[model samples]
Target: MGKILGIGLWVCIVTLGAVYGSIYLATAPAGPSEEDAKKAALELIRGEPITIPVIGGGDVTGYFLTRISFMMDKEKVKGQTLPTTELMTDQLFTLLVGNKMVDIGNVSSFDVNDFREKIKTEMNARLGEGMVDQVLIEQLDYVSKEAARKSADGGSRPMETTTVVEGEKLDEQPASSGH
Candidate 1:
């Protein structure tokens, strides 16, 4: 009888402990939840390379070769195709050719920040408010008519490729001769 009583006591104690543990856990405050810790998921969409002609003195002086990328809101773009190519090409032409944003002689005059903002703003305005998160420039380069002719004529002068990032200028690197 005593042994049976002790067994029952042990079972009761374990049952009470389990109940207390469950109650404590259930009543405890939750830590940072997934929703609270989560950030808006953004998707990166890379646009096709654009070539805009720089016309001056009634002639095509040089060509601006640019590749633009965009960061879009994942939720907003779900089940939808963005008209990025058409919009980007049009805006880039307006900025580069129409506005003369880039100076062929003074490449340092290019403002990448303003360029990015305008693109982002215009894209968001066209698509929808808060649809675009950011505008990224993958490539922004200028090839002069002289340089093109020189390379065509087999001149060995290295074709320089300029890399611009977030309004900071990187050193110009020599472009490979071959396509």
Candidate 2:
């Protein structure tokens, strides 16, 4: 009985050790070194242009008002300037509009973060390196009479107030007069 118990204890110890070992290995950080990180940052920023389609439209031209660049550090950009610029051009906006426009109303509803992630993925693929950490939108605006009108009018114009309902239930009526 003692022998059996001893063997069982050993087996349990072995199993526990194996489990902990695997867990430690799996959760270990595999982040690149500073040098490799910098290299990746540079490579991502030096790749070809990537265009992403926008959604919704009227007879409007969309423009990226802010700088179309990703920062690795304060000094380094994630991708090359030309490609990044091209990615943020009116043409890219048009392509997005063409591909994604479900209705005119859907244009303003965009997930900025998702778009940035998409750009990052594309850039990484093109560069064959994971360098870009994020893409940021400096400014985004649409050039069109309608777009201007929408903005000026406070988004499709202020909705008119039809009526004001004061307190008191409409179900109860005042005492009726009987002659």
Candidate 3:
């Protein structure tokens, strides 16, 4: 009877310890940011902006220069025997190539925050679930194709010189010349 009592007490103590241990682990706080390597390792995939022609209405309308950075799952990426940088950059390039000038330049029509979220969603979809949680826009710029062409043809001038008159916008167009 004495031996049985001792065994029962040991079992109770073990069970209580397990319950408390589990609760502590379950309620523990999350680790550091994705860029931190001390608490939790993170991998940064960088992409530089490149000139890409924008095709619309069967014509090249403009060009886009875009750069993106993504925070990837460090553990998973390290485990794989693949070139993580190339993989991530290719995915980013694919996304940038798919956007139109209007999609990027019309910040007034489309909210910049919404566009950022859209980029995050698209990046995650390509990189895999939980692979990328953060997307940073390093650079994004647009230039009309015509502007580049004119500049190449020794024409240097600013486009869309505007003046305000009674809360109205007035855009001055370039004058045509004939010899």
Candidate 4:
């Protein structure tokens, strides 16, 4: 009877220890995640404002004027040529023209978060996973075709673009003459 009791006690102790160990492990805080790694050593690269014309029903309706900026991994982009301007332009065209993401008539219904997430996903896929930490919208607005035409007739000069990297101005160039 004593041997039986000893064996039972050992089993119970072992069971308890196993349960405790599993619970502790399950509740323990995890180490730094993939998102944390992406956040490390980030560099801010602000691109020029891109103007995308919105066409619908066989005519030009309006334009999507947006300034796209990014938080990129400094270490990962150290030796690579980041074609952010070209990529962003292509993506914007795809989203605005090809996908018809934004409805000009119902501007308030646009989902800004979804737009940002899609841009980030597409950009990261092209640049490599986790290369683009965040896609930021510094400016986003819509200009009606009539409004744009009026602005042009009023002799408003086009704004110049300046590439800003890490809060420092890199270079300046004239905005594209094309709409």
Ranking by lDDT: 1, 4, 3, 2
lDDT of each: 0.68, 0.44, 0.59, 0.68
Better of 2 and 4 by lDDT: 4
What is the alpha-carbon lDDT for the whole of candidate 2? 0.44
lDDT of model 3 at residue 42? Answer: 50
Candidate 1: segments with Cα more than 4 A from true spot: 1-40, 79-95, 161-179
| Whole-model lDDT, model 4 | 0.68
Model 3 lDDT-worst window of ten: 161-170
Score every model by TM-score. Answer: 0.60, 0.35, 0.55, 0.60
**Model 3: per-residue Cα lDDT over 95-150, one tens digit each:** 65646525544445545556567777876676566766666666555677877788
- Worst 10 contiguous positions by lDDT, candidate 4: 159-168
Question: What lDDT does model 1 reach?
Answer: 0.68
In terms of TM-score, how similar is model 4 to the real structure?
A: 0.60
Error of 4 at 167 (Å): 17
Q: Write the per-residue lDDT of candidate 2 for residues 18-137, one digit (tens) a residue.
A: 999999988957777887776554322222133333324453443222223443332323334444434434433543444542223454456666666765676556543544565544
lDDT winner, 1 or 3: 1
Query: RMSD in Å for candidate 4, one decimal?
Result: 10.2
Kindly list the per-residue Cα lDDT of model 4 for residues 1-179, writing each as its tens digit.
99999999999999999999999988846777776765667766666778877777888877767777777777666645645556556766666564586665566677877888998888777668887777777777667787777777874765322222123233344432111
How far out, in Å, is residue 63 in model 4?
A: 0.8
| Model 2 ranges with Cα > 4 A deviation | 1-66, 73-97, 101-108, 145-179
